[model samples]
Target: MTAEREAEFDFTHPFYQTGLAIGVPREDSAGILRSLGALLSWQFLSLVAGLGLLLLAVGSLLWLVERRRNAEQFGGSPAQGIGASFWWAAVTMTTVGYGDKAPVTLAGRLIALVWMFAGLIMVASFTAAITSALTVSNLQRQINGPRDLPGLRVATVADTASAQYLTEQRIEQARYPDLPTAMRAVADGAADAVVYDQPLLQYRNRELGERRLDILRNTFAEQLYAFALPAGSELRGPLAQEVLRVTESAEWQSLMDAYLGHR
Candidate 1:
């Protein structure tokens, strides 16, 4: 009697028939509903808030470490204080070393020990964080690191976008006049890879021992490089946005296919 009733109930439900037609199990549908519900819950928001807090904490830790070093170095100077330490930390990490200030005495030199090591780590970590954040922010919000390249030496063409990007990324490199000179530097063991655009890099790959050198997949800025001015300069932000948009489009993919001829 119970088996006959269950069979009738199953046949009567049109929803079950529809689910079978779509090849979705009822259990799977229920799981999807649960997932959707969770996404709408406070737990998801709390997770986001927690991640934000973690980032803030990391940033603060870096800042405090820098402050402590600065205080130890220049505690005596009238101009040197916690605030001044912050500026100094930024400069030091950026490797600007403007030499506007100096540290004196035994205590200061001791403090230098901590700064020297911590500064390098802090700079690399901070660069990665800021760049990653900025890139994501610019893409999502529509607004907007490294060690020395491991090789005997490397070169970038002077005043070009490649040079600018490499310099900004803090890669150890020299500047050369022409592509051949840069290539020569690498060929002769004076350098590793000549940092340049896709076209130039491709050319080098063909002309040189292709297997010998490798292109660093790590691209600094995806957008076509542009210049910024003090003010009233036309073709700055618009040009940058235009370049970025094109580079990310399907047309650009076709262009790459034609130009590169290989993935």
Candidate 2:
């Protein structure tokens, strides 16, 4: 129970320990421009450009080694040789094995052999790096935890503890009438993310069949779920006893596991 409620009523010992969690859409194709911007990130572009430069350097080296003797495949002129070498580097690195170009001289063959092995490693590394970059860009919305709430377009249910917490913390939010509406604000791109009770967000996330929403594990603003009784109510003592008794039992753990799928 919040301090505000505690002053008016007696509450049993907390039965459940939960916290506010952040929820975000896994993907919202709502903004084509935003997706494109992420795809063309500086890190991604730099990797591509760097690979291109590597190809050029390898192609130039091959031309220097093969231009005099194996001119048939290397090319006739300096310009032609460089262009042919470029094609060779690309095909070789990709393992296409077009058979249109083959190094003849010992030096050229040695260089090609070295490139073949290096290309395998480079290709695998670049592929993994690009995939990771895209995945991070797509899934991460700069809201990893509570500290990221500042200046974010956060959504939450109005008149709830989550809302009160945001207000007291001075974090700006777009309050909705309920949890679904607040979560929908995030899915439709109206808000960057949603903040709400952990169990509520988790349940809603699973119910969203499309699996578009994900509840972050970064729980904050811990809350206690308790039974509030009228002042001086006799049931308060018995209820508190029951809560503590039940919560301490193995059956409680089993119940939680059956419903929440055991942490």
Winning candidate number (TM-score): 2
Q: Which stretches of candidate 2 lie over 4 Å from their true place?
A: 27-34, 37-140, 261-263
Which 10-residue window of candidate 1 scores lowest in summed lDDT? Answer: 15-24
lDDT of 1 by residue, 127-221 (tens): 56545544432232111012334332556688876676666766667889976677666655455446666555654455554333444444444
The residue-by-residue lDDT of candidate 2 on 75-169, one tens digit each, is 68888999999999998988887999999999999999999999898889887987787666555575789887887789999888899999999
Runs in model 1 lying further than 4 Å from the true structure: 1-145, 148-152, 166-171, 209-212, 225-254
Per-model lDDT: 0.48, 0.85
TM-score of each: 0.31, 0.57
